[model samples]
Target chain A: MTRILMKGNEAIAEAAIRAGAIYYFAYPITPQNEVGEYMARRLPEVGGVFVQAESEVAVGNMLFGAVASGKRVFTSSSSPGISLMQEAISYMAGARLPVVLINIMRGGPGLGGILPSQADYFQSTKGGGHGDYRVLVLAPSTLQEAVDLTMLAFHLADKYCNPTMVLADGMIGQMMEPVEFPENYVEEPVPPKDWATTGCQGRAPIIIKSLALDPVVLEKNNLVLAEKYKLMKRDEIRFEAYKINPKNRILVVSYGTMARICQTVIDELEQENISVGLLRPITLFPFPAKEILAEAIKPNIESVLTVEMSMGQMVEDVEWAVKDKKPVEFYGRTGGIVPTPEEVKDYIMKILAKETPAVKSWNG
Target chain B: MLTSFPSFDKRVIIFAGAYGSGKTEVAVNYAIGLATSQSQSVSIIDLDIVNPYFRSREAAFELEAQGVHVIMPHNEMCHADLPIILPEIRGEIERSDGKVIVDVGGDDVGARVLSSMVDAFAPKGYEFLIVLNARRPFTSDVAGSLKMMRDIEISSRLKFTGIVSNTHLIGETTTETVTEGYELAVEVGRAAEIPVAFVSVVTEVAQQLDPNVVKVPVFALSRQMLKPWEEKVKAVRGL
Candidate 1:
């Protein structure tokens, strides 16, 4: 296949199409409007369906209904728009429907700025919608990774019979890069969902519901959902460790576009003979916690730093993973301001400077 | 300095392209190159209302440092996504003294902004060039690019005088990418009855291009639009 330049949002939409996702429901939001725009134009040519619903509220419900018919379906939205769809997202999770959501995040608390941000990390990994459920969250740092993860998201969602999300920042959505789709790739056939609400001509009608009225049944349902999440955790954890070596003293923890920036920081510091490593989490939910801890507990690794475009949301998870075996530090810039590599390098230099005396005390 | 390069000789120059066609990058580089090379006053008007990221105005600091005046929306609404056209844009387009390069937004939706100022352009007789990146999905071929040119012309109420063949895959751009884009641009230009104005290549790739294959003037672009992380290396170098 030929390599072509594509924006992250457009690539994700095309990847979904290639993965046999025939139905798309979405409302337009900046930084990610390209996803819907690409789908609306391309889906029709491939005998697929594209619906511009009245709002995100309606878009989410449309996905819930469409996926119930056992067709591959997905939706894309930015932060606030994703917020509006949380109720439907929760419902889909409860009903155990397989669907894909692409959240090209922007700065947010309310209707935030349209610039790139990773503030939605908590909202995505921790469940934006209420209830005892989780969405399989995948964060991609590049357009190519976005495409690969989007394809994987459909497969994973179907495999687990749950909603999966591609959590990315506006930078990933808007940046242009060279990407190649799998050439005439065929997906492994998934077994037909025996639980789908297909026609009931020869047998009893099937009903899928999230509302377990009885307390005992509700607990059992929640437990079943919990077990599915455990299975995902066991089989689906993904991450990348860049420049991990015994010579490294500082380990940088970051994900999405922020991880790319951290990679640059590591390269810059390596020039100064200051060895630093990076751990980029690809799966945000089953978030490579053991991988982070494994690196943090190494003898030469003095401290771990979590950098992000948000005000240190993922730092909590990083700290939890480290469990104080290595001092975990946090540096962040929120409101769509991405922390520069120079700023991050300086922050790491500060940690190195501060840790010298602490190390001397411990050694003495 | 290279002697043979695309020169915007017209008093008023306008650039429009499909999304990710490298129009804004070309516009910013042209303004800076013109300002740094010549003593003439240069000002770039960022009239992009469609895209929220990678607009020419993002390089205002660098442009101003190079003595090229940068114009866009006012301070408070600078980053707002709303289609806010300032009166100063009209003033800049109407001014007769200096060179004005207008970086219009992408596609027909963005080109509509130019239609609003068709009267201002009529008197100036602007050189409207469609920046074509053949790698982009919409303009990947001669037919598709010609259709985009027609669509933009209809929406902007302005005919393109030339084509700026700017095709690259960012860091992965090769000489072949530039040549392929030039080939597509030439085909589109022949079909549309317009001159293939020039070819734009990233400065590094431009240096490596075989002049025998490319007969037209080349505009070597120092990339102005950069991702946050990519900016760090350039910033540290103090460029």
Candidate 2:
């Protein structure tokens, strides 16, 4: 009904409440601490639950507990905290429990820094935890998109009986932008949490487990997970292409905050007739390989530049998607450094200025 | 007796106040008001480096579309948490004409950045107005508001010339709330020894108030901070 200026963290917290997330358990982490603070202060008015767990490990288990009881719940964390929660996340994934996790990523292999980053791309999309399981990962580039995707994450998690991760960078978490909450955005038509472990009263006991000791049963569990992943890839592949006209010679590929930066690069370059287009992946787990493929193979396309806020993790996927059909170049700024639009534009120009392709072709 | 936005004889107007005092929103509305008034060309520099959560830059496109130039750090830096102070701002500050609105960050830590521009701004003085919201935490009393203004002035190396009360309690804000806030604003202005620039009342609530009751001019405010769901809740509950 009305638009309001809101920070991404606070917006997500309010959106979760608006979406009927009755239970939220999270440990405080930078660039996302506001989410916990907002929930702790506001959840009571809405008849919801908010717990500041002692640690990330505890919060992860708490998430599993809430979801096991068939309630909408989520937790937000940064890189190091998410790393500590991986064990419980792995358990939830293997157990096929539905939960929402918002990872507002910061630079890290360890506690690197608190600035915006997309370095956690591999850890998120390639399955951080142990198994053949995949979390439905949604990457949002703007504050409104973050709110929209978070609401969608709850639906996706419940509909598939799988954990869904809202993979945003520190920028999306800390930045202030105008956002509108969907009118009465409550989680509706709740897919029967018929599998919940709510005290089996006068009914058959339900058990949800990830610990399978027998090799045969474990293999079957893995296969079942693989099938779910396959279905998610088939149905949930989301991507957005900006200005991918025939005259464009370069395809800039990125997602989340990086994609947003590339959009600016495209805008600035369009003035000079540099003809750069952007292919942004909205769902990082499904990877949007098909859409990127279609745009990258266009007749006038000369090169594909995979830009990231990390050491070229998504570039490998781009290369694999293209499979040497065209050269997929990588440009990234790691360790909490967010590359400027000028830097990205300059990087692309250097690639374009080359007299010929930098790499030898796949020739006969 | 003033019935509309006030005239600005000064070239540059700087908005500075304590955190959550509604400075950014006031600056946005004030800038828009000035732009629409055709008194001068307007440009806004978002100088808030302390809080990345709310700043004037978020409304740049809207202001720009209305022929108001918005100057902020380019690209991701506009959204980043880094303390990015560019030289481009100095150039805007040096301009002798037009209304240059500087929406500074809240508190002294936010105002300290202005110290760097002292050399460029000293000769041509600016109107430094402290936006006051009595409802904001730690500012309900006259002493607290003055203390905050003193801290900001000491750090910014500039004295405040006026005060604007832009208080609210979100969707529930009423004329009574604005009246109470105005009482505090008057008390704070008397204590701090500054003029009351104006008291902003939401257009809906402003209609119900008597202008004679307000000691200073009333600036009719159209709330720009409400989000969609918040407005829905307000509409449903009749807030």
Candidate 3:
């Protein structure tokens, strides 16, 4: 397997193509526009349908149309554009379509600015679109994870019959890094077409829609989605625990770009004679809740601090995972801003001083 | 005769135009017009991400004074690189009050930010208007304008409700330029499957030309800044 230097956006696009996405429709938005550009040139080479849709609305609907035709499809956009696609995304989730959406988030409130920000954490994991449904969200911290998760996202979306989102930020989208494509690219077997809108033949006419005017039918649909989500929780929980030991006192939780930043903070804290560990969540929707609880049960761990780019959206999850076992703290910078490694290290040290007796002993 | 304007129970109208199309000038005046036309609360969300100068923020003071809520990204966290999804704006979307005008940035690139809120507005009805200046680059002809429309739609992921034909060259624009631009808009409107909501004309020329030159209703625009009632009078007088 040859390793090549690729940008995160390019890697995800290539990964999607190799995963059998034959239709790619998108409008170019910065930070992730390169994904659309790359697919625009490559999709034609692979005998795929590539259209720059009329708007994010049209692109999303086009994806819905392509996915409805029983073909693998994907679309990429930034925060603002992804926000526009929420209507379609909700419909895809309700209709149980295996659509792949890549959100390379940028700064926003109203065109906040085109820079990296994790302000979309709540939107991605908690269903950005309105509906009683959830999308399988994969947050990639590195370019390799971006490629790997995108490949997995396709399989998961098809297996569970739901939409999947690859949630990354501008830094990951723009940064060039080394990535090795999978040796045996897993070709997902075309599942039974019993649920698709590929024509009725002799069977009942299939309606692929999210609307249910009848309350009874809508409740049944909600139950089905709920059952699928429960199964997903059992089958799709993923995370990376770094430097976990029985003697560890602090658990630092983060994801996506923040997870990479936490790694640096952990390294610096280790140099200061503090035993700090990290719980990096790769799947934000099927969040690694059980793992955090399991680590919290260990008596040596004293506290968990969640670091993020937003004003503490994901911190709520950290609190839920730790419960009352330990004091969960939150440190964050929001609105298109990122905190440096040194600042994160300072927060970690402050937590350690307050919670760990060993750190107090060393200071004395 | 009676005029019926498109109204929503709680919809946000975003007046997004191309750069140098006097979007700030139109947005400021339109917000005032919309606010006074009906006895409802109208808020202006300044989402200009391109061309730092001549933004809706510049008119924030005047708009706020007119009792129109002015929401700018800078009031909270103004960053050019991070994704700052405004949870506060969600409140406005959920409110059953007046209109929220989102004056987005110019061009497909700048207007792309609307895609982020696809989740929020799709549930609640949101109407997006693409203000077109046929004289601007990429909109100088029918084909070029269609391409721009397609790009904006794909990027924002929101269907444009209608087109606002606003063709002017600062002070150089005339009734002839406005008419040619209106004609070009008809072709674009047909291709995009959307109607030309209004054709904006300067008050000086609007008074001279037969209002029927614009197939759609005419909206009067003034170069000089004025109160909401004054602007509404201009738009209505042109009609």
Candidate 4:
């Protein structure tokens, strides 16, 4: 394996290619467009299919077409453009198609400014498209994680027969960092085309779609999806805990780029004699709630702060994880703005100062 | 003509223009100028959701290598097409450390998306500059340019801070074309009650034109289509 300096976008694209992804369909949107450009040039070089579809609508359907043919496929886009692909994403989820979608998020309610933003935290983790479905969402903070998670996203989607998303932001997409390419880029064997829409020869043709008219069948399918999501919660939960000593009193929760900032904050706080730790959720969906809860049980911990780029969207999950074991505070800056390490440290200090006497303990 | 507007406290500046109006080229040059002059960190956010060709997002890696943050939606999100607001960008805007340039897509429809974040920006003192290319359709004349500005203002819910007149043809652009565009911007500026902040000229023509022809600031735009020419010139001139 060779270590190369790669932007977050190129890392994901290269990792996907190494993970045996053969079909990529996408429209151009900012921050993440390099992934498409890279795939457009690289996909053909490797005998893979890359289509710059007419629109997001067409690209999503093109994804459906390719995935239904039993080929690993993926697409990428930003906020407003992602809105156009929601219908198709819902269809893919309902159809139980395995596809990897990467969201290099930008700020937006509608065509928001193109600055790096993480306002899509709720959208990505809670299911952006309609339907009683959940996509396996992975949030990567570093270029290496972006590559590793994207490669794993394909495997998870195929193993569970579901759509997976690499929920990243403009910073992650645009940042250049050194990443080691996977060793032995051996293509994974495609699963047997048992359920693909490739024409069934002399047998009943399998139809890949989300339209279920039968009430009984629809209910059964919904139950199956629910069960699978539950299984994912149990088996796929991942997180990175930094400086989680028992003496640590402040727990900071963040994901993606926010987590990187939180790490810097933790480092600064450590130097200032303020005990702080960071719990970064790599998988936003099937979020690392159990891990957070385990950390929250430390009697010495005073409070938990959920830091996000959005105005406290992920704080709900953080509060849920703590379950009143400690007070959870929310601090964030939104609309394509990033908080500095000093600001994050200040926020943590404020929360720590407000802690009740019962919550304060000196285990150290 | 040239006029330099007073700098605001906010770091992010959005340059929005119509399709085929060379907005991206103007934005790229403006960003480079801001970065070089101030020796500060600058980012370019490519918000061009329409017209995939020659978009700022295509220059993400190039800009990143130059140390400018390039924030656009990812390729996969383009497939989902769901309205996904990346809040991480909001975090950056709040940092108050560097200049952030947003190159929005063409047309008022594309510009309308900025309305939702007016609340987010109001307190932060961010400024939105609409780039007007007199050569583009709907902005070919003073009246048409005013209409476009009104529509953009109505959609973005943010008042125009100023105007950057960047009139040019693909390869046929000249100093005269830029001058005429600057004059048109001046007329629109009077009508719209905003200043013509700057006039953009191509790097080649910029050297030939007298700096005093306009009362406003002059920006030198380097075209992506002409990158090889510029590279060759750089090598020859030892720049």
Which candidate has the highest TM-score of all?
Answer: 1
Residue-level lDDT of model 1, residues B41-78, one tens digit each, is 99999999988788887888899999999898876577
Which of 1 and 3 is the better model by lDDT?
1
Highest DockQ: which candidate? Answer: 1
User: On a 0 to 100 scale, what is the lDDT of residue B69 in model 1?
Assistant: 93
Query: How is the predicted docking of candidate 3 categorized under the CAPRI scheme?
Result: incorrect
Interface DockQ of each model: 0.55, 0.07, 0.03, 0.02
TM-score order of candidates, top first? 1, 2, 4, 3
Could you give candidate 4's per-residue lDDT for residues A179-298 as a string of tens digits? 777687554564565898778789897878888999999989999999989999999998898899998998888888888878877877788888888899988899888899889888
Show model 1 residue runs off by greater than 4 Å.
A355-364, B1-3, B233-239
Instruction: Write candidate 2's Cα lDDT for A232-288 as tens digits.
Output: 989899988898899999998988877877887788789898898898889988888
CA RMSD (A), model 3: 18.3
Interface RMSD after interface superposition, model 4:
17.8
Instruction: Write candidate 3's Cα lDDT for A167-186 as tens digits.
Output: 99777886555577887885
User: How big an interface RMSD has model 2?
Assistant: 14.7
| Candidates 2 and 3 compared by DockQ, better number | 2
TM-score of each: 0.96, 0.68, 0.60, 0.61
Whichever of 2 and 4 has more TM-score, that candidate is 2
Q: Which ten residues in a row have the lowest lDDT in candidate 1 chain A?
A: A355-364
Model 3, B1-239: lDDT tens per residue? 11223343546777765544556676777787778778888888777765333356656766777778877666424423234446566677666467778877766777788888778778777767778776654467888787777888888888888888877654456777778888898888899898888777666766655656665677777654322112322221101
Ranking by DockQ: 1, 2, 3, 4
lDDT of 3 at A90: 92
